[model samples]
Target: MKIAITSVGQDLESKIDARFGRAKWFIVIDTETNQHQVISNEHNLNISQGAGIQTAENISRHNVEAVITGNCGPKAFTTLNSAGIKVYSAVDGTVAEVLEKFKNGKLKQAGGANVEGHWA
Candidate 1:
């Protein structure tokens, strides 16, 4: 399984970014191999609108099975859901820490959007 974790920086030690759409980076990890890649989300940060949807589309192309982030807005949540990607929100700490929690089934899958659209 490949999971994408929103991050403030490009590595496992980086703190988790609270905003899903405008997060600075996404650390996508392949659970089976323990390998990962960093995807920059800078382009979405300054968008006037549709950041959430755009970000969702961007990550979907990476084929991540799930997304672990601090928060997810309505549009992004729906988009991810439509693409068969699960969203896990309200997560904190470093990317490595959350990855362990997810691997251990300690993280809860979000049922729907935790925040409204246009959330920064």
Candidate 2:
């Protein structure tokens, strides 16, 4: 499975970013081979509006199967759901730690957005 974790930096050792839409980077890891890639979310970081939706759309293009993040808003959640991507919210710790938790089935899938839209 391909999982994308919101990260504060480019590497797995980097801490997980608490804000999904405004996260600095996305660490996309393929569970099968342990290969990964980093995607920057710089464009959405300073956007005044539509950041969540835009971020969601951008992630969808990467073909990630799941997203692990600290928070998610309704619009972004809806967009991801429509694209057939699962969301695991309210997560913390380093990107590597979170990835391990996910692989071990320790994380819970979020049923809906955990926070309101326009969250910083």
Candidate 3:
């Protein structure tokens, strides 16, 4: 499975960014191969609005199966859900740690957006 983890930087050691829409980067890891790629989210950081929605669309286009972040807003949650992508929120620690948690099925899947829009 390909899982995206919001990050403060572009590597596994980077701390997990709590905000989904405004996260600096997303470290997408392929569980089977252990290969990783970074998706920059700079474009959405300064948007007047719709950052979460736009970010969700970007993630969906990358064929991500799931997203792990500290928080997700309503619009992004809806968009991701519609695209059959699972969202896991309230995540913490480095990208690598969280990946391990996910691999071990220790992370909980979020049922809905944990915060309202513009939460970042």
Candidate 4:
């Protein structure tokens, strides 16, 4: 499966960014082949508003199956859910660490947005 992990930098070694919308980068990885790519979220990182919705739209375009992040807001969560993308919340540690947890089925799946909009 292809999963996107919110990251502080471009690589798996980078720390996971807690905020979904304002994350610096997203590390998209394929679990089977172990291939990966980094997508930057520079535009949404400091937007005056609507960052979560915009960022969620951008991520959905990548066709990622799931998202790993510390927090997700209402608009973003609703948007992602509409696209059939699963959101995993309260995730921490490096991109690699979370990937491992996901692979092991240890990460928690979020039922709904855990934070309010414009949270970050």
Candidate 3 wrong stretches, greater than 4 Å: none
Per-residue CA lDDT of candidate 1, range 1-120, in tens? 999999999989999999999998999999999999999999999999888899999999999999999999999999999999999999999999999999999999999999877635
| lDDT for predicted candidate 3 compared with the true structure | 0.93
Local distance difference test values of all predictions, in order: 0.95, 0.95, 0.93, 0.91
Number of the candidate with higher lDDT, 1 or 4: 1
Q: Which stretches of candidate 4 lie over 4 Å from their true place?
A: none
- Tell me which residue pairs clash in candidate 2: none
Question: Listing every candidate in turn, what is its Cα RMSD in Å to the true structure after a full C-alpha superposition?
Answer: 1.5, 1.5, 1.6, 1.5
lDDT of 3 by residue, 1-120 (tens): 899999999889999999998898999999999999999999999998888899999999889899999999999999999999999999999999999999999998999999887645
Off by over 4 Å in 1: none
Best candidate per lDDT, number?
1
TM-score of 3: 0.96
Q: Report the Cα lDDT for candidate 4.
A: 0.91
Q: What CA RMSD would candidate 4 show?
A: 1.5
By the lDDT metric, which is better: model 1 or model 2?
A: 1
